[model samples]
Target: MLELFKIKKNHFVGIDFGTASIKVVELSYVDQKTILENYGFVELGLANRGNMKPTSLEQVLNDSLKKILAKMNIHNAPAFVSIPGFSGLVAIIELPSMPAEDLTKAIQFEAHKYIPSALDEIALSWEVVEKKEEQGEVKDNDNFISKLKLKNESDSKSGEKIKVLLVAAPKKDIEHYDRLVSGAGLEVKAIELETFSIARSLVGDEPGVFLIVDIGSRTTNLILVEKGLIQANRNIDAGGEEITSAIVDMLRISRSRAEVFKKEGKDILNSNESPLVVPVLDLIVGELHRVISAYKEKNKGSKLDAIILSGGTSKMVGIEEYFAHALGEEVRIGNPWRAIAVGSEMAPLTKALGASFAVALGLALRGVEDYKKK
Candidate 1:
């Protein structure tokens, strides 16, 4: 995560540069309410998802962002951007409580175990998510004297355990997104992982654990969020593109035609052509089960409240019903715009855009949250 500029604007922009398209959302905060101002999206052909080189992709995104901003008449706004889930790491580590200085060094050492790149190549960040005593009770970090007393009492037994949320992203990936926003004439206010943005917009202040299954064009991000905090994150290489390819190969149709068929085919998951798509969904579901099981095994006595589905592919008809049946859990599509105010003129778009703009909206909401804090 990168924080470069201070919050100084009421109107904020969020850009989600996905593999298949670029989504931009502009929001304005007024009178303690967040209102939707403008939004734009440009679809990058599914067939060209992984074929484009890095430099080519950069040029395409730069041009697309510039065109979208110019068309929407949004200029020079402070932008919050999201790095793809596959390009970053989110891990929850538990260690015996110690001094602040020792904790910092311990987290750095733990980061090396999870991050493949060297420490110098990665931009690492961490925070003490919570501290727990031997009896499984949470300890407040703010009450230093009380916490010290409790620690002293517990020193003879088991020390208090600190659970830290560790986040790491490559420096090059950060610089890549920074250049994308800067080239489009927007100041880079902050850069965060897509997982955090998705959680912020969809699961804000919601109690209980949620697994956010964000199926993008080329990858699926399986985020296990407990009380709006990311507990475990897993990304799969299969996504909408894989489903589209199955349709193309099974029906012997062109990629462009298959793309349209995917969005228009109502109840396709249960139809005869269901074979083409169920595999991809099943792949994601299989990963979901593994992630949930791992999280449960690690943190006993915790239950996953629900599964929230987001991303373009989630807009498919009957998807919610299909997932509910498959997982036997309360499955629903996320509404990122639920808390944002939209006028009658834009109300019609709420359902159509539904879960697709979650990352973008979450990024924009971060700016609003920061402004409110100031």
Candidate 2:
């Protein structure tokens, strides 16, 4: 659907390292568009790995990557990867008139208030979310305090206090990823937050209010986006694993069997599994309501236009209808493939795996952009 971009790249890949699986997508940009070249995925075997050590997880992840890389016939491509959704902190901090160097220092000083640990303990990134008015209409100045003459980030002159989205990730986590990517013989072009990557891949230049609920194996991430920028995001402990556990407990099935049932159960709406899975789904629906309500309250009852469902668990049967019925909004599975071109032969695979590959697609798109700038 994104046919207007005019850029070309020969080599680009995006890898998504999630709690339960690793997904990778290889794409090439040609003729002013993005087209799917190749893609692959492998389960990390972390779904039911209770009390798994970080070291062991790393080893297993590397092993899985080796297999998926071989399967895709991928060797040594510039790569962009995703950070676990829950691993970092994102905050909106306001800063007034200041020099470029001073703004950096101010962000560092203000970061401590949001990040629990020392500022030096993590890598920090921030972007200015400036509020701008078009042509003849003047936006409410309540939120637009004033704009300052900024040399580096902006050119506003009304002296508005700019809102910055701050992101901080632990240094050790990044180091671990660096070693992991290097071990696979791939160059690390960049690393980014999974939510932002999702926005880039699925929401790509769309100016609308959207709430994306990505139900992964270990966590469910709720992200609020307004006019193409992330407004608020939260990653909760509840996800597919919790539902699997419930099924395993009530159905008395093995973890592996629960996984299969959770994925393939067709009668989830009215079958025996309903008794076991309804409570969890209902609770998630309630949480969705709370997230939307909070965002609405913060933005003067700004309504959510739609909910974009993503991740593996979002593929569950009846999931869309269940959420749509409960949330009273349009709920549909996200099409990460919409940004790229694919043949009819891959249509079924895309239909089945589109949501799960969202982060990887986003990583590749962002990675491509970053690569061109170099």
Candidate 3:
């Protein structure tokens, strides 16, 4: 999480730089309602994903940004971009509460416990998600928060447990985005984790804990959002491309045909009938089960309300039913338009690309709201 700042801007342009493609969304206020002014995307095949120099990826992204800007007729706007999930860390930590001043130092000391890099190697930011109730309250955090300290350890007024969402991004990663955005002739106004942006746009004010399954081109990002704050994020190497590759290998088909088969082959790909894609989906489900079980144990056997799937791969015709059957939970595709006001002219485009464009649209919407607060 970026610290809350006092920056102001007019137009909100969000650039979601992904492994396989870049999605840009430009938003403006019309009659005090956010309107989708322009949007565009560029597919940069296999450039920065696996093995590519930072400089080469920067050049490619810069060139792509220029083309997108020209095609959308957007210019002179402050931009909010997302840090890839693989390069950042987000976690929920609970500790004995104290003054705001002392809490900052305590959080820094605690960051070393979870962050892989040295304290000085990464930039750390955090915000208090909630001031949890003290021992034996309605909240189901008995397994962890209560263990941080004894119930009589501190005074009731000041020793209440506080839970915060911590975010860490490497300094080099920040510098990389600085160069990429500057090289594209846009000032970088804000940078946030991609999963956080997706939650903001799609989950909005929906209450309770939600498992966000963002299956991207190269990886599947699993995020747990509790009471609207990002609690935990986990990433796996399996994704849409890998699933397609599995299909291609199983059926001896081309990548294009495999992709089409995964999305359109309804009869052969049903939840029970599709043994070919079952292993791949189950691999993802196994990881999800780990997170779910951990969360339940930590939260006193509570279960997640629903699983919201967002990404290009989540749009498969039978994916919702498939995952629901596998996980035994309600599953549905997220709607990106739920966060912003969309006029009739952009309805079809919003529906077609909602899942894929979620991150970019979220950054823009959150940016505009944050700007308005200034």
Candidate 4:
């Protein structure tokens, strides 16, 4: 059985480790509102390219975290960190209902069927999403005595039938993050999958089937969420760097110059009469369309309600309009910090932080209700 931890209304920090940068959000819960205490980000000098050996990347994480912590004066705080979507496995399945005590064993057995690793090699966790009686119709019509007897039998047999959402992460990956945060002089209050965080921040309290596309420095995460539940998630190998590299090759510019152009080129492309970047964008958009089409085909009969574009790359000028035009769907840039109150002057910084921090923000916002029960 999974033990629930009580999360209190205390100051907490969320650190998002991305390929090119680290984003840190400090949140304070006061007067029933989750306030944005402070936020900051730092560029990773070593792994900016998104490819690094595990050990080298660990060093970069440590260094960048140290700098960010020092700059933010975050000496002691309960921290919540997230594992990248590419690093873990998440699935929703139906299982036989039983006493909460037996649910863990049942989930572990079911997890073995979906997880590629040995059961012992991964840390497994599950949450109950729905519960329903399988044979309550006949019992509902019975007399009180007979109904009571049927309920007893049903409870006993319920062991074989129930549904659940299971999430598993490789033990090594979990330990790596645990060590990383502990080494940084911060206590890890909770660790969550990145996709789950993105779902919470982007999907919010709305009820609909929406697709959230997060284009990060090294990878693009495409997730299909329905009614606040994640139906499917896919991580593509291409991201902002690929787009920038294309610009570098076409314009024969250095990587740094290419990155600058990638962000601010629409104005220059219009006025300077330079070789347009449309061909490259077309390729990127084409690939995105294929991914979306495949997702739609797999989920037939479900129309996508909207497309939410998030991540640092989405901040590029005209990207939202380009996606809206290409996909023939409503496209809105995701602002993870939209719910929190930050000063108006920091709006641009918040925009630049992008959808990449959605997960971290949600994880950090792990509510006081959760803590109160514990």
Identify the superior model by lDDT, candidate 3 or candidate 4.
3
Pairs in steric clash, model 4: 6-371, 7-371, 95-162, 96-160, 96-161, 96-162, 97-158, 97-161, 97-162, 311-355
- lDDT against the true structure, per candidate, is 0.79, 0.74, 0.75, 0.69
Lowest summed lDDT over 10 consecutive residues: which window, candidate 2? 141-150
Which should have the higher TM-score, number 2 or number 3? 3
List where candidate 3 sits over 4 angstroms from the true fold: 1-9, 47-49, 132-156, 265-268, 271-274
lDDT tens digits by residue: candidate 4, 1-374:
45344433377888777777888888877776667777888988653444667788888788888888889887677887777777777676777666665666677777788888887777676656555333221111111110000112123344465445566777777677778888987877777777776776777657787888888887777777767667667677668887788778778999999888887747433334554464545665677677678767976876788889887877777677777877788888887787787778877777666776776676666533234335
For candidate 2, write residues 285-364 as lDDT tens digits: 88888888888887795778889999888888878877887789998898888868887888788877869898899888
Tell me the deviation in Å of residue 306 in model 4.
0.9
What's model 4's lDDT at 242?
Answer: 75
lDDT rank order:
1, 3, 2, 4
Candidates, ranked, TM-score? 1, 3, 2, 4
Cα TM-score per model:
0.88, 0.85, 0.86, 0.78
The true-versus-predicted C-alpha distance at residue 102 of model 3, in Å, is 3.9
Candidate 2 similarity to native, TM-score: 0.85
TM-score-superior candidate, 1 or 3: 1
